[model samples]
Target: MVRPGQIYKISANILKSRLQMTIRASISCNGVEIADVTQPVKEGVPEILNMRV
Candidate 1:
């Protein structure tokens, strides 16, 4: 669960045994872009991509 007035970390995980790739994403609100992020994912590893309100 998420609550107000708190920061959170967004993450992505790769569960495959032999897969790797780069993730690109954008966060927007009201048609305005807030964050642009890129994260690399390796096999069986968790990537913390962004942390914001």
Candidate 2:
């Protein structure tokens, strides 16, 4: 989703495999990392979402 302030909202599906797995989220601009989320996602579950992105 796009907003007026040049802000974008993105969502991703974190797939799970095996008994142990890890997932992360991030945002980048100009080849530089901006946001990073260090969290693991559970299988068959939607990652926690923020509506007011």
Candidate 3:
């Protein structure tokens, strides 16, 4: 759950991809978007996505 007057960090890791593609992520709190990120991913590689709100 999300509380008011607090800061949060979100993270995600991508692993074991067979094809290269783009990853898009959106973070929202209480129907309001806080962070939006777009990353390009490669095959057989690991990628980390991080955002702060």
Candidate 4:
């Protein structure tokens, strides 16, 4: 779904393994590609913060 004032490309891929599995995702919004992000998989935490909020 496309929202007003928002642009993005969403995709997904899956990897199969014996002891481990991995899912890959790629997202690009408004010509800015978002890749290579590191985060804790168990929580919803913002990597960057805004001081105004």
Best model number under lDDT: 1
Q: Candidate 2 on 1-53: residue-level lDDT in tens?
A: 32334444445454655554465656566688755565455666555533222
The residue pairs in collision within model 3 are none
lDDT of 3 by residue, 1-53 (tens): 65555555444455666777888877787799877677887865566765554
Q: Write the per-residue lDDT of candidate 4 for residues 1-53, one digit (tens) a residue.
A: 43445444333322333433333344456787544332222123223311110
Q: Against the unseen true structure, what C-alpha lDDT does each candidate score?
A: 0.70, 0.51, 0.66, 0.34
User: Where is model 3 poorest over a 10-residue stretch in terms of lDDT?
Assistant: 4-13
Q: Model 4: which residue pairs collide?
A: none
TM-score of each: 0.61, 0.48, 0.58, 0.25
Candidate 4 or 2, higher lDDT: 2
TM-score for candidate 3: 0.58
Cα RMSDs, all models: 3.6, 4.2, 3.4, 9.3
Better of 2 and 3 by TM-score: 3
> Which segments of candidate 3 are over 4 A away from where they belong?
1-19
Off by over 4 Å in 4: 4-16, 34-53
